[model samples]
Target: MKRDIFLSELEILKGIAETLNEGTELKAVLGECLRKLLQLTSLEAGWIFLINQEGEYELVAAESLPPALTNPKHQALTQGDCWCVSRFRNGTLTKASNIMECKRLENARLGNWGDTYGLVYHATVPLKAGEEQFGLLNVAVANKEKFEAHELSILESIAYQIGTALKRIHLTMKEQDIKIVEERNRLARDLHDSVNQLLYSINVTSSAGIRLAKEQPIKEIMADIQRMSQHAQAEMKGLIWQLRPAGLEEGLACSVKKYGEMLGLEVDLSVEGISRLTTLQEETLWRIAQEAFHNALKHSGEHKVSVVLDYKQNTVVMTISDDGVGFDYAEGTFLPSMGLKGMEERVKCMDGKIIMNSKLGEGTTLKVELPIQQRGKC
Candidate 1:
């Protein structure tokens, strides 16, 4: 008889593990677990609760429960608390404990609202894993048989599995939150580099036009204003592209060309090899390219720019160059600006390198080299 009981308990534990692993949905997993518990222990009914963010217990799942126990007016599952739940809620009952008789059941029997069905005893187990407290698991039975130590141990093991599942779900939610924050930060950086700079340029151009109006030809001043207006339109389009993901879907090379065309610059793009990269790596390259292009447009005064993407067996290299006059790199006086620093930080975070080469009267070249297997490590 003892051997038969041990086999049954082992089978129940196997079923519980399978139930938790089979699904990622919390309520479905927990509901199935409660059902299996009732089958294994000969319990009449069972319920599981989850503590909300506000520290109140909420009914998450139940099985074979009586109507009186589930009624909203009675608030048996929602508001009212029995001795077992009260003890569990107050941190007094951290493990599976038997309640010889529940006040809730006794009160219902006395009031004659419904049949207690001989369910005078129940057990409560704190559903917890590590430091995470999910809520409580309750099971009731009609028989007067006292819960054995082994029975409580089985309950505790099942509760531990449930808690493990909940912990994974929690961590998954936190990861999603982190991704959202990262996206927001990317949008902020793009706006600052593109739209904000264009606005500043418009202000300076308008002021220059005011001064030139007194000395230069009206036709020339009008032409300058027209050019500035075109730049404004291009900036607006770039901002819209950043807001929407259409450019990203079209591929990085095509998107970069479109951005350059909008800005009225000649773009020469070259791809030497083909390879695959993670979405994050692709986005990083695209953003760094956009920043380099913006710098060329604003400072290089070059009519043409070149961008090259080279994919090798173990590494990918990017080169951005322009034909405009460049500054001297020998002067240690050229401190890194915010945009440059941001680019450098991004490259370093990915275990990459950024190299800049320039001399007076020569154009600047920016090179970025990144390992190909960075995503594989993740």
Candidate 2:
């Protein structure tokens, strides 16, 4: 029996390592870790506390926790220091063998709710990678009891793995932020050189027109204004095209397909008669498709989604459809929910139209039509 238990615990740890290696988002990874730990170990309830930038251990994930433990008094433990937490903070609680019953639970049991969860003894492991400690991992079962030596070791190992994954996640987020800021700065510089300069020229021309009202021809000033206005429009479109979308550079179809895969959905993509599309048109279509895909996954509860990107003369048509429980979209009643309003606003900005087709218990389809080439672009 002991051998079998050891093997099962090892397998659970392996599964958790694989999940972290996949570069899954941090929150999802932490929740999955807690769940796997609960399933494999004697612990019935578990939670993870992560130290935020403010250096306070916040409850980021929990499983099977009772209402009393989640109440305002217990939540204050996030920012407040307790014996177990302080031991970890002071570098005394380094290993899982340093087991102790939680004073917080003892205090809560004395409260009006009356030991709502029966939570007493808990194993507190520091989430440490190298010299850095991210936070603490707490796991407990009902009543006061000591944990086995092997169990403590397993819990400690899992905490170390979580710490390592947290480090990677932190670095990944930092890199992404730096990239976004750099891209925005570059776009700002481009706008200043192109559109900003042109607008300034228009301002100068108007001032000259006012000064030379009798000497200058009104038609010439009007012509200058028209020329500058057209150029400004084109420049603005170019800038908008450069706005960020995770997988846009690859292609709109590819980006949407990858997005669905990330959401654990199979997306069938069909593209026809398109060698390439103008950046502005591609971006607008991509944003609308992204919003539609998110809505389908969140509210639709569908396993599979279908996407089609078709290019026709002077027009690009994209459709996203899902087979899930649909709602009655009256445009007024359901506009705010399911994020349809935001999608509509995006389409309007692109000077395009979005058609919604759905019925309760049927499905949803978002059909978008955008001009392939806007003013001054072929």
Candidate 3:
């Protein structure tokens, strides 16, 4: 019987681990987790309360509790009023019995109508990971019931499991956020270098041209205006490149090679058999190649670049490298002169790997590999 119970707990843990790792949002998963956790642990009512940015534990979800829980006045939850949540926020494990009497609830109104609720025992535990407390889990029941000592131990284990899992999810999200910021930064840089300067020059020259055009007597100055107009037209073409992805339908390799030729660089793009690839795989390859070409010309200032696409086992891979001065990528540093970080982020979103190999004067090579599972129509 003991072995059966242990196996059951393991199975529940497996289910929880799977659910948490499914890339589901933390709040949604935690709400669902509370229900499963309560059922698994044989608790009557369980709730997961998340601490807000202001450090208040607001009831996120409850499996069962006071019907009046819907009413704010009935819940004792207040700003900075939850001890378990606060503890978790600081990465501390805390457990308390008779949870209603906990410090946060002592001064709480708890709503006078829920007197029958007071007779039940409540336990509060911190849901902790790292040094941050994302929330608290509470188990409550009215009427006297004894909690087995082993049961409390198991609860502690569950809390630890929840904390570690939550930390992993948080880390993944943080990396994604950083990548998004990097992409935006790269786009801004592109505009500044390729579009902004040209437009600024055009504006200055156009103003001068208008002043000269006003003087019909100065035929020599008219030539200057005509020259400035040619520069403005060139700037407009650069803007068009910015407005549209130059090579998407033709494939990423095509885009990269086109971009290289446009920049007067010798670029060779290679593609192996991708007859079995879905559209998502092809698009991702295209984006990666596109970004790689942009990075080489605009950032590396390299005159030559190469892109290789291949399928190895279940992974689709794109490798782009250039013979330019390489910089340290391990520092997690984003140089304004380089858009490497932004390129890294886009690859990561596809559940891909971005490996940079470089040394000073040795040149830089970027390899992105992704496990392709079809997410769109073929």
Candidate 4:
């Protein structure tokens, strides 16, 4: 009996591992895994939640939920707060254990919402990879008030596997995003180097032809050619700008200054020390600078902004400041707003640091520091 039980657990784990390894889409993977786990363990239901850094929890996967939880579009599970989630947000639920009772089920029973199928308790496990906590895995069985010790242990192991898989998927997605950005930049560079130069040469030659032509027809033809070339050149510039910032090849500072000017802002730009940055580093910095400039223009109530770029000790530092009105800046609360989260993600992808300071009625300042040596590491 012991050997059979061990083999059963092994088969369950092997099946789950294969499911996780073969999947890339997060919701689909979690749903399939939950289905398999519940079937193997004879549990009645399971669900998974993915919590972001902002303490927002999303119902990523669920399987075999009773009518009480699923009726009216999963209102019971998705809408209200539950004990496990509260504990998770408060940093109390760190391991797999039997929660005393399922709050949602109890509430359903009290409210006479629907049939719960005798589900009164659940096992909650924290999903984590190394030190990073992602979310929770919860499993419940009908008429079961508690889970066995070995059951909790197995759930813990499965949660760890799921967490690690989530980490891998996230990293893969990030890498793909980076590659897409790099490829777009490369295309922009090609257009600027080859097509843009050709258009410029055509415009110049047509202008010279108009100047030297003696016949009226010849001069008119040259003028028409010049106008067409100019229009095409402008369109090309717009396309390149969509792919990557203009003047970026000259330097990061130049690109940012030009962008600010285009946005109708008075940019006071200064540069110190020579910069040794990779293409990815330059791209990341330019993006962050653009976001800062945009925020200043929209929210700061000031037309003039200051930008400082400095390179020293193999690190590049940039500071963007606005003298207009600023809002209270709390790292935890404000990151998801004002496009700051996107900037933070870009910096993190490059293994860099970003800091922002702001206060009500005061101005805002954003600083970014990136190491030159971290280029290869990222």
Candidate 5:
């Protein structure tokens, strides 16, 4: 009857385990599990071991093994001396009634340490669920006493608790990795289509202009090439930086002013209330500005670039335009316009829209507007 009860309890544990599965974090569930398991089994002490990459068991959570033995200092096992370590790795739960006398534990990893080990009676089981195994859960007694069959069932159930919890942690980690990869891909495409193109134009044009200036008496040509060369280098640097995680303080106005000065572009940035926005909004604004400012300095035959940031009563708006000879806003320009599409996508992600106003003879104006989102402060 008790054996059937123990099996039913394990079944219940599997169902109620969804709580631990919801998160990869282990501290709360792990502590709760050990506390309940020790009480359930009436064991003198219970200790949980987590397998390291080196295939050694490290003490994670423990009760009654003393502070020193509960958190063992000599954890790493060498060679085939780890008999208990091998037992769990084979995907089976095992027990050694008397660790000092068990034949299977002869020459096992950490076996020699038993004489030095303060705890004597040991019950070891693999912490596993399905096919994946994490490590071993072991209980030890200072005195030489064997566990009854009922206590063994309790120990077995504890293993299942750890197994289910660990499985949840693994799933959470995998999902997190997926999200990171997706974010990286989106950002990479944005960089390639926008920043890469502008830098390419600068590099190509500057090289040609330099060659022409050398052959002919064209002082202005040489100056133009020199300027474009510097700006291209700056664009390359800026693009690489955007591919990385941006620091929270590095906003649109600050980055543009610093980068423009670094590349010798006389930039006037008028940013109002940029710092007050959420981190996501700030990042989106900063990236879009990077592309637009690149356009004004490199392609727009403009002397100065102006970037204005403003937040209205219920709207956030940013306007970046150049006093350059603006070209006709046609689908032809848009087709080859990687920068425009990237800017649009970024604004869309922020629940915003973009407007472009340009004339062949006059200058250009690019405006972005987003409704004030009810976002909680990070």
Candidate 6:
């Protein structure tokens, strides 16, 4: 019987390994793995939370959640803090163990959300690859209060596998992002060397023709050509700017101010403390600033925007605000239509924090904080 149990455990591990190796899409992979785990363990339900460095948790994957948790689109799981997440954030949940009780579930019961399916307790496993902790893996059985020691051990192993998979996915994504940036730089260089030079040559030649022309009609034609060539040159430069920003060579502040000016906004830029940032950090900030500025240009009716860059003891903070007519904005929720999702993802990739505030009549504010020291994981 012991040997049989060992074989069954080994099979489960093999199945999970296959699932982890299947793909790089985080939510799909995690959801499939959770489903497989619950099936093999005879557990009623399971969910996964990916917690970032700033204590913000995302419900990345789940399987067979009860009505209480599912009603209103998993609001119960996404909105509030639970015991497992609090423990994970405080650095106490180092391994697999039975948590006291699921706070979210208790809230659902009290709020009369719906049935919880008797899922009041669960085993929480801290997912970690080596020294880096990713998040938590939780499994629950209806009316099952405590998990066996062997069960906890198995869960620990599974969580370790999931953690390793998470690391692999993250590294792959970073590599892809780096490659994309490099390609964009190469394309920008090519455009500047080829098309931009050609346009400049045309403009210069047209201007020389206008100066040398003996006939008035010829001079007028040359002037028209010159105007068209100059316009084309300006358009090409704007395209190259989109591909790769120009003024970043100077500094982030210079780049941001120039971009805002190009967008026809009065930029109030301020900087404090010595500037120290990695290349990746600078690029991330630049991209986020571009998005914010574009959003402000499209939505905010104000003509001026304020930008503040401050360096603290261990972090850098950037605040972009405009005093225009604003739209309703939630703190954690990002509106898909406004292109804030990309900004959020970029910040999260760098282990940073982003906070947004807006009201109907007041202006909008976007603040991002990034750690000074680089982490090996990111």
The TM-scores, one per candidate, come to 0.50, 0.54, 0.48, 0.70, 0.45, 0.87
Q: Could you give candidate 6's per-residue lDDT for residues 1-378 as a string of tens digits?
A: 121122378888999999999999878889999998876767789999988887878888999999999989559988988888998999998989997678898888898899999988889999999988988998887887788788889889999999999899888877887788889889999999999999899999999999999999999999999999999988888888778889888998999999889988999999998788876778878887888888888889887999999988788899999998998877768653446777677677678978889999999998899898744233
TM value for model 2: 0.54
Give Cα-based local distance difference scores for all models: 0.72, 0.69, 0.60, 0.83, 0.60, 0.86
Badly placed stretches (over 4 Å) of model 3 are 1-7, 51-55, 79-111, 114-119, 130-134, 214-378
Runs of candidate 1 with Cα error greater than 4 angstroms are 1-7, 39-41, 52-55, 115-117, 195-378
Q: What TM-score quantifies how close candidate 5 is to the native fold?
A: 0.45
Error of model 4, residue 212, in angstroms = 1.8
Tens digits of lDDT, candidate 2, 7-73? 4776878877887787547778888888877776566787887653224466778898766676775
Pairs in steric clash, model 5: 81-108, 81-109, 82-108, 82-109
Considering lDDT, which of the candidate structures 4 and 5 is the better prediction for this target?
4
lDDT per residue, candidate 5, 1-378, as tens digits? 122223355544654364455445655566556665555434456666676323545556666554333224443222233556655555444542334443322223254534424444477777777755667776665554566566566666667777877766655644564576458657866776787677677767766776666555575676676687677756666655566433334655676577566556777778666445655566566667667767777778876877777877777788888878887885324423597787675565344677788888688888877666521110
- Candidate 1, residue 296: how far the Cα is off, in Å: 45
In model 4, the runs with Cα more than 4 Å from the true position are 1-7, 246-254, 263-378
Prediction 3 global C-alpha lDDT = 0.60
Once all C-alphas are superposed, what RMSD does model 1 give against the true structure?
A: 18.3
Per-residue error at 126 for model 4, in Å?
Answer: 0.9
- In model 1, pairs of residues that clash are none
lDDT of 4: 0.83
* Deviating ranges (above 4 Å) for candidate 5: 1-22, 26-32, 39-41, 52-56, 67-82, 89-118, 141-144, 204-378
Q: Compare candidates 1 and 4 on lDDT and give the better one.
A: 4
Please give the lDDT score at residue 222 for candidate 3: 54
TM-score of 4: 0.70
The TM-score, computed over Cα atoms with residue i paired to residue i, of candidate 6 is 0.87
